[model samples]
Target: MQGPLLLPGLCFLLSLFGAVTQKTKTSCAKCPANASCVNNTHCTCDHGYTSGSGQKLFTFPLETCNDTTSSKTTQGRKELQKIVDKFESFLTNQTLRSTEERQEISSTVTTILRDVESKVLETALKAPEQKVLKIQNGSLAIETRVITDNCSEERKTFNLNVQMNSMDIGCNDIIQGDTQGPSAIAFISYSSLGNIINATFFEEMDKKDQVYLNSQVVSAAIGPKRNVSLSKSVTLTFQHVKKEDPVLTIITYVGLSVSLLCLLLAALTFLLCKAIQNTSTSLHLHLSLCLFLAHLLFLVGIDRTEPKMLCSIIAGALHYLYLAAFTWMLLEGLHLFLTARNLTVVNYSSINRLMKWIMFPVGYGVPAVTVAISAASRPHLYGTADRCWLHLDQGFIWSFLGPVCAIFSVNLVLFILVFWILKRKLSSLNSEVSTIQNTRMLAFKATAQLFILGCTWCLGLLQVGPAAQVMAYLFAIINSLQGFFIFLVYCLLSQQVQKQYRKWFREIVKSKSESETYTLSSKMGPDSKPSEGDVFPGQVKIKY
Candidate 1:
């Protein structure tokens, strides 16, 4: 019985092995070009290829995988245009001024744009079934996900993907749809689309070299129900929406914190120190106050997008405050130039009087009028979905940038005049203030004043092509710490203020010693003997 059972089992195993071998042999058969056999009997096109436009033949020999680049160029553009046209319809029919609606529009438009862009990238790069995108620590899978609108109960689904090599670094940094490339670049040309779409050309530290060869811009005029065409000018790039650099965030917050501390100290010093109270310190005080309020409001309320009126009010306040700060800065420069012209005059007494009369009205009034004009004209352009600042549409940003640039230009001229006058006239004035005569001190003060008077913002003007990132970091760092610079130059570095601080410190120490001595003496009874080194009645000789 055991032998019979073993024979049957061996027969069954042999039959199973024969079936497996047959399947393997069938799958190993030669397949059509750009196609492969799978599951022993079926043929499928290779990755990046699709089957020919015909019915499958019995022998599976007629089907072929064809390249999709030309077909994709024709069909993909049609689909993409439809998406853009949909957005254009929405823009035409609906008002998107509210912060929430604007954000929804931005996020939706970019999502559509990036999806089509990714398909274009796959065609360009000839990538396979996997997404061409190469995120640092994410999967290669692609699937649609829901985008739930926060402002309303609306929800839509979309996929975010890109096609690029993992080895290609900084090819996707996506700087404002700006790129220089041997590779074609794709971007959403309209500024209203927001920063959701981006592309990067240079890798880190490679920006300074090969600065000129950027790709062309393709303008798509997607009108309501309009047919759109794709041009060869534009290509697509990818950017992952990730949190900002932790290091930069830390640096910004830390710098702002230091600036706030310094501003407070400077304000207190200006208020209390009678010795340093002067026209310069007064200008510094107002500048410090404006900056303090601006930065504080920015840190706290810049992203408070809800309650739209509140956000607009905050934007208006920020605009006014920052403009006022720059206005005071202009006053500082004018006063400095006047001081240089009146070098022989002791204490800048007459200049000080002249400034006091005009500073308040000019410093506060100009910003008020500018804001009032802006409010009266385009009141709705105050806040954006992302930031509580002037809108960039319809040349509205110029309301701020225009005044700033003018002030910067005037300040530049003032700074140059002051420097020239100081160099030419310093040696001739014997009775000039000691602070203004020391060449090193004077040079340092002049440079510091230049920065404080908003010359550093000129760095923004140089933010083009290759030097954009460098100039951006410099501008952010220097301007963010403007309050600290004012305090350093006007309060901590001033000889008069330093002297006052030292005097105050000495007095504090002296009083502390006296208090300790009195406590010690009081602990002893009236009949108790004084220490051996005691001076006249209850006086202990204190050494400071």
Candidate 2:
């Protein structure tokens, strides 16, 4: 799996097999008794390539496949017949005459589509798997699979697979799914005719499928031979392969559902649950809210093409929102340090929600706005599906690099102050010094997470080399699981938040118990306090 040898090797083998292994035009060795090579290339059947009459291509295509003056081999004709029958059955099946039938057909088609696409995925999963495949024909894909396919289960899908040497196929482009699993399925069926191979995931029983054959270019390919690699466009139907694991999508579900619900809960907690609204808890709650809302909108509405155009808009916006909220959380940590620095009285006049909100906009928002404007003006500069990231235009160096510089600068300043202050305090006091050390360490961890996130953005610039891919996945997985880290640092691991949460839980339980004790299910009396079940304020119990 040395880097230099992989792609070139694949290209050579593919080109070799495709260019040389090609059969010489002659009387097909597999052609029937009546079959004749009138054109010196194609082995014409008594009928044609169509069903019921045309002899198959067992040796119908290449001249080398011909056996002049001899009858077609039985095996060759039967194999050809099999291919014809599969296509013919689609044209004639009467079971698919209704809307319900089409849905059923789509399901069956997916099963078959998954088989082929999975081959590509499975092959890719192996050690030193092919990351990209370039087809000289219609740039088709082979290793794609279905992900998040919980529409229904217990249904089996029917699949068909083919391997061809050459075909009359031309493709514009091909792409992988945005996520690990396949997002769509297509049944693009086509014949090689004279010099190419065409493939479809499903054949439309009728016009209802409205299966339009569209394509794009990608740097990858899947084939009959594992070793042969070619940059030919092999017509492909971007098949949707189903994903089977529930555990993998737990976070997706959390972000899309539970995390979103947490946004509302956090907001309500702030408004009604008074204890959750202090400086530290409030900041954490607010950060959680922004993340929840942004993802909710992103997951639900970012799929349509015209609206999909909002991918950049959404990506840019979410980037800011995500970063801004995270920044705010960082800022909150800074504020705590400032208070410890004896600067607590600097802004005790009144709580400035507006100022805090401004931090989020400035933190994630400014960068988002900057990147969006940069990408819109020079979109090609934006990374496509391969890099699978937000791309910036000419000034991206500024938009991206600028933020990193600022964030890192701020972190440096904080750490310096912390170092100086902690050093001075450690000499006189051990208990206080230990507390400062742990607090500083938590801030360091948060800062490191941000640094990593920033690095993810920077890595987009070098999407060409092998290291870039490793870093890309690192960025993707880390960013994807950031919430867990935040939870660990702010809630689970932070004893401060743990104490607050325990106190809040007890209050909720106590309030619920009080309600039941008094039989006060309905708030008929004005003096009645809203039950903890109705409100979600995080209060520092200060139990002592």
Candidate 3:
């Protein structure tokens, strides 16, 4: 009886398990191809596929799975190809060709180039998984490269070719800062654009030789900012271009080198010569230091276009240093004005204290803030294609030029005010010959300083019209040798500084003579040792 009962119970359990397994298989049988049923209750698309309704899990039998990876690539290619088609249409349009004014044609060409570059870069960034995309339409061609991984040590730059035009860009330009995601660059070439914007647009071109566009009009840009300028100059390889004069390059290098040396000497004099250590000398020292660094960087790295991030950093540093130099110059003018105003005061301890309080903040902090704001707003304008300097596009150069002009104007006003004050002081002190002479000397120095530090910069703005060539040369020559002017005025011309220099020279000569005499006596033998009177003991030595 027990065996019979146990057999019946086991059969009933086996039958129940079989019925459940059959139900589960029937439910999963409804799942479509390229999809799998989960837990016998819901369906999920297989790898490399997505559900039509975008649901990860679904019970609907009508849902279908689609290949998404292939579709995305197709969509990205179509989008880029569409850009090429649109650009080709724009260039071939009859309305664009009918335009007469060269300026209008040039402006339209620029707008078209920018638009094409921006759209290509945008599309590439949106579909960064498509690492490389190239499309060629009727008269236009575009190629894009997307970087999503760390650049190898061996490959610091990437090159993109479109038609006969090509661009070489630094890897860091695309990666930008430390962003660990994708960065994309687009290179575009227009076969017909050069016809519209030819050599005629360049006013500097010689009219004697018949010049025309010899290369395709090409544009290159990086996303997401898509600035007109690049951090490193994109080395554009085209069919035709001219070379710059080597003579001018040599002159520039030599001039800047000499100026750097002079600035160094001026800074040292301002620091070491206690006689000239005042608020004015402090201003001079800072000015010299700023110019020294600016010139040194300009001479060495101005044309360093590789490693885009480094070039941009160099450009920003140059911007800050030059602005700092001008700011210090403004401070110099302010100090000169204050000194002139308080000529009657025997001591300027109060003035010195005031300057000390405000000078560092205004002189250095102002430029730093200015550069920060400029960089934050339009970082792409920090470097250019030809040089590691502010780009002259979209009025971006005004970031540097605007401040310089304002400072120059303020310095000019201060100079005039100081001159007026000195005149009044001189007229009132006419009875005292010593006072008149001092006032006259101050006036002369003020006049010289104004020209040396402020007015010469005006030559840069005068580089237009028939005299432009003359003004360019003059500007380069005078401005490049600014350090020489500073050294001459602050160290060589100042009576107090001149005296200190003479004293230093005498001390150096005296030390050399004593050393020679001691060596001679030592060479004569032990019997010829110098006596106690001949040896100067415990004399205070200056540590320069």
Candidate 4:
């Protein structure tokens, strides 16, 4: 009886142990392909694979393992690789290469590069959270940077590298477009592209030794537009080619410096000569101040590219200062219109009071508001890599140009109205010779002022067509010498200012003569002062 009972118990124990081993095997058997069980407990996707559920280790039987690199970034790489392969095949295949002309080959390569850039930027934008994506193969390489933080102070620009080529671009260029949210830039480099579309494709490469394809053919672009032009110039640091002309820069500096000095003198004249310190002179004074500050800041800090935030601040300041100048020009127009309207009135108090009330707010507040709106909307567009000025991207320059054009138009209309009013006033008051002469003088000064303050800026807009080069030079010279024009028109031309200048000059000469006489008397010693001619006025001669 004992032997039979022991045998049954042993068989039962064996059956129970076998059931436990079967359960452990079943647990691991449920894991999908590209995944394995860990310690017979949980499932983990293999290297280069990810679980559909996004977990490293998962026990759910429904979870599937997928290729981790097959996401958007991989898709981008594959697209770029496909383009490279197709181009390579086209280049290598004798049948294809033999039929294509040199121009055709160049065109085909250009199309490929543009396509690669567009595809890479599009892919990077699709996954902006990635921030950066780099893909490399034997024939091609690409690197992308996504700027989604609204270009904070710490990240105002970006530098990207592919192969041995690199690009430096401002964040604003990438972020400025119709689309909102994140922006991305892609740099694609082709290892074999330079060989086919090398220096030969460049029409400017006339000299063999002077120019050659020193680096791999690289393409850069920003999404979603992928425009060939950028608001800021992208600095492409090729391995062996580089260049800049400083002649224009030097001209600009010297011209602006002279204008700045003239502006200072004109401002001093306007402030000190109480005779010319009326509403019109005040307008000239403010305009001179604005131009003075703008030119001074530009001379000092326009090229200061480091500490990007400071550059941006300088740019904002320039924008405001220039806008303020134009605003004052508008005020001048209004004042001229009011003065012309009230030319026959005895008490010009109302016009003066009206001007005093509105000039300050309109001159300064309007620009401040304009800058604030622009900055709040797109602050990144304020500064660029090369200069601290308004950017040309997305019609951003219009912030300055728009106000300028409007002011110019209004000034022009006011000018016409002023002349109209002056014409009637002069016609009716023909017998009053003094009034007619004063009105004619006023008309002449208005014409000159209008030309200096409003019309010269039109040259900037005319910087296109056949006359672009000429217009550019004219714009530079006339606009840079704006301070000189102001001083010339307002101070040197005004009879009152001339009289004051002459009086000041005479006083200076007299003071110098008196100073010399005192020096001579001192040198001659106390006992040697015998000449009565040496006694200057306002000095009491002591009698012993």
CA lDDT scores, all candidates in order: 0.63, 0.45, 0.79, 0.80
1-544: candidate 4 lDDT, tens digit per residue: 8999999999999999888767655778689999988988788998657898899987777799997544866776677678778877865676655578777877877787777777787778767767889876546777889887777764366888765478988887777755577788888777656645553365456566555466667777777765555777778876532122266566678889999999999999989999878888888889999999999999999889666699899999999999999999999889888888888787888998999999999999999999999999988777754568876545789999999999999999999999999889877934377778779878987898798888789998997778977777787778888888888888888898899989999999999899977876776688875465455454555444
Number of backbone collisions per candidate:
8, 63, 0, 0
Better of 1 and 2 by TM-score: 1
List CA RMSD, all candidates.
23.6, 22.7, 18.0, 15.1
Q: How does each model score on TM-score?
A: 0.56, 0.40, 0.57, 0.58
Badly placed stretches (over 4 Å) of model 3 are 1-243, 429-431, 526-544
Query: RMSD in Å for candidate 1, one decimal?
Result: 23.6
Q: Using TM-score, give the best candidate's number.
A: 4
Clashing pairs for model 4 are none
Better of 2 and 3 by TM-score: 3
> Residue 231 lDDT in model 1?
25
Write candidate 3's Cα lDDT for 1-544 as tens digits: 8999999999999999888767655667688779998987788998667999999997667789987767666766676567666666765575655665677766766776776777787677766767898876446678899887756553488888876567898887777766656788888777656645663375457788756566677777777764454577769898443234466567678778889999999999999998778788888888999999999999889989666688889999999999999999888889888988888887999999999999999999999999999999888667654468886544778899999999989989998899899878877834377667777878887888888877788898997789977777787888888888888877888888889988999999999889876666565566754444453343332232
